[model samples]
Target: MEQRTHRSEVMLSESFMYDGVIIALIISVANNLYDLGVLDLANEFILILIIWYGIIEHFIRNSNVINFDIRYRLLFYTTLLGGAALNTIVYKTYGISYIPIIIAPMIITLLVDYEFGASAGLILSLSTAFHHHDFFMFLHLFPQVFISTYLLKNTKNRIQVAKAGLISGIVSLVMILLQEPVRHFYFSMRDYIVIFLNPIFSSIAVVGILPYIEITTRIYSNIGLAEIATINHPLLKTLSLHAPGTYQHSLRVAELAEHAAESIGANSVLVRACALYHDIGKIRNPEFFVENLKSPEENPHNTLPPDVSKNIIMKHVTDGIEIARKNRLPIQIELAIPQ
Candidate 1:
């Protein structure tokens, strides 16, 4: 009972920490927007807080994807709010360049998973529109931002990300031109150049920061998960050498899980990756496990009582968790170690 109470207290404390971080981000963005003259001091700043929190609450209530993983929740708000903050600073420093606005979706989508990425883009678009009170800018940018999520949804490498950028550039350029009708608008070379270059440059910038973003977040985008699922990973190599039977078991489990996940509209790549590393703990007691034993007659558990054997069998869950943590596997993969 006392242990359970302690665990509850710990969970509450962590929840407080999470809320505190999100609140700080909100205030920082709000304060910066006011400082930049985008929001009036007294009313708009407070209103922005209310609206922003409302959006977050709505998102939390509706989103299973972000809510399922604490890391995703944190990363979602951080990227969304952080992008808003950067937009303010850039807009303040440079008169009204839409560079930050153009690139915000790519960064957010690349950092968080697609579902959060799509949601964040829409949130950012609304926040940016409200900040400047420019509904047309919102109209102009929102579609591209939303479109970017779809483009990057299945991306598997830098080249694919770059290709997503190319598509975004084309789509954004069309939107820009369509909104400002060519028949009525005067086209300066500089104006034409800005329209063409904004998304192109944004894509290049996204590609440039992709590696650093992956390292910092450690939350694999679908593509990143695929990349990490390779057989050459050091932990898999250790499993192959130290516990061959367990290694083969992992491979078979991965195949079965991947197939099942695909049939059910789940994340097959993620499921397969988790399955591959699920039994890493057996590396420590390879000879004791039935599957890894050299001789079927040399039964280790048969010599032990039921309780002791049960304890030994259960210890692998804890052991696998430890190994997963030490190796810095993503939380999703580590979470599957027990089952």
Candidate 2:
């Protein structure tokens, strides 16, 4: 109970810190816009405060949609802010058509989920449109954002990401042409190419940088999950060699959990990955575990008191967490070790 209380306090402190960081980022961005002469300090600043309030309220109301974990929240908000900053810089330097509007949505979709991706895309589009005072920017960006997110659902490979980007680029090109029909026809060929290829190049850039993001954030995308879920992973290979029975059990559990997750419309790949690593702690004391014991007489628990055996069994949870951290496993997989 005391531990739980301490944890709660820590979480509350983290929440306060997260809130401070978010507000600071928002103010910084607003001040930057003000300096750029894009925002009128009188009315637009008030409007931004209102928008920030709405965003906080939305997050509070849908806490499950946006994870409470500090890392996840920081990543989500930072990605949005970064996207907005990039958009602003690119818009000033290369014009609105050259803004990589799909970057935030695509990266969030691949790293988190469709819901988060879509939400980020909406917020980004709304904010960008307001900044530029152009409703057409929202119309132009929102559709491609949605398209890129939808196309990249359950993405398993780099090729799929590139493909989604290509499709989004095509959609963006169509929206651009439709937005100003007569003006677009008068556009130079280079202008058309820039507008169409912006999303594609942005996506390719995401593909190149995704591994680094995953490494820095410790949040694995489906692509990363897929790679770690394979049997050839170092930890799995070690588990197979040291605790064959537990390794086999993990395989069976992974299969069942994956099927169950799919039936419930959950992330089966994540489920499978978690299930595979759930029993990894047994590798430390393979002989103590029933699955790894060669015979009934080989049960080490037989020589220990009930309380001692129970403690030993429960120790696996902490041990697993230590191993997971040492291996730099995804937090989801580490969390599943206890359950």
Candidate 3:
């Protein structure tokens, strides 16, 4: 009940903020469009893209959490503007070069969701396409974006994130492939340097910011990461203390799930997170599991039929989620528990 109230309050407070941001950004776009002269379709599209991205970002993705914390707000807005800014920089400085702007979106996609990242990428690309006054190149940008980002999903480690430079590089290559057979867009080797290498190097360097963000914010980013080390979290120590067997089970599950995710190209962070919570229900009945008790204690379920025992066992998933929610765990962590 307390948990549900907290959820309701958070929702009510954020409801206005999210609606307000969208409404404000829409007006801002209209104002900017009118001031810039409503003659050009390209400019009109950029305004539309901004609003669309704003709506999707704040209303859909971010509507879940409604706090006024500066760190995360900065994360959201920076990612929004950053994508557009990068695209503009790449296109203006080096013609037809999109790698510069895509650098941020690739990482943002991994840390966040493909939907948000995709919106960011589109807004940035379309912003550049319109701003540069090239409708053809602008409209044709989606192919590379789709192929590149899709392949990069399920990245859950530093090495992979650091290696996202590879993603951008591959995107550039895909863009090149899409442009096939006699499109001499860049002037020379130096221009190609910006076109090809900027995204690769930028992606690698840009991911470094994530750790700094994590450190300063102490937020998990829904990527299954947190600033809390082993000693910092109680559940880990409790698992080590009174529930060693459950601890071992969790470890095994984490290991297996992680491997399965890696093998099948699933989000390894999400899989590992689920493994951590898979047995949280057991915390309510630690001794019921064989390892916790020296003498087989009387099964409390002896008082009830198998159906009742099953209900009790199944209730832990909801119980664990409640505890997690009370602690303000990320939705990703909450998702780790069974439905």
Candidate 1 least-lDDT 10 residues:
36-45
lDDT tens digits, residue span 1-339, model 1: 999989976785566456645654574465355454533433344554565455544555466656567877677666666667776676666533354564656766665556556656666666566566776666766777777777886566677767766676677667767867744456566766665566677778877776566666666666667877879998899999999999999999999999999899887988988989889899888877888888888878878899998888888889999987787777777777765
TM-score head-to-head 1 vs 3, winner:
1
lDDT of 2 by residue, 99-143 (tens): 888898888888877777876677667667766677887888989
- List the RMSD of every prediction in angstroms: 4.4, 3.7, 7.9
- For candidate 1, the TM-score is 0.81
Where is model 3 more than 4 Å wrong at Cα? 1-42, 45-78, 85-99, 136-144, 158-164, 170-186, 213-238, 252-269, 277-291, 297-331, 334-339
What's the residue-level lDDT of 101 in candidate 2?
81
Name model 1 segments beyond 4 Å from true: 1-56, 95-98, 102-104, 110-115, 181-187
Candidate 2 global TM-score: 0.87
Ranking by TM-score: 2, 1, 3
Q: Please list the C-alpha lDDT of all candidates, in the order they appear.
A: 0.69, 0.80, 0.58
lDDT digits (tens) for residues 203-295 of candidate 3: 666566666655444345433352322334676666657667887878787789879987987666666766776666567667666656656
Global lDDT of model 3: 0.58
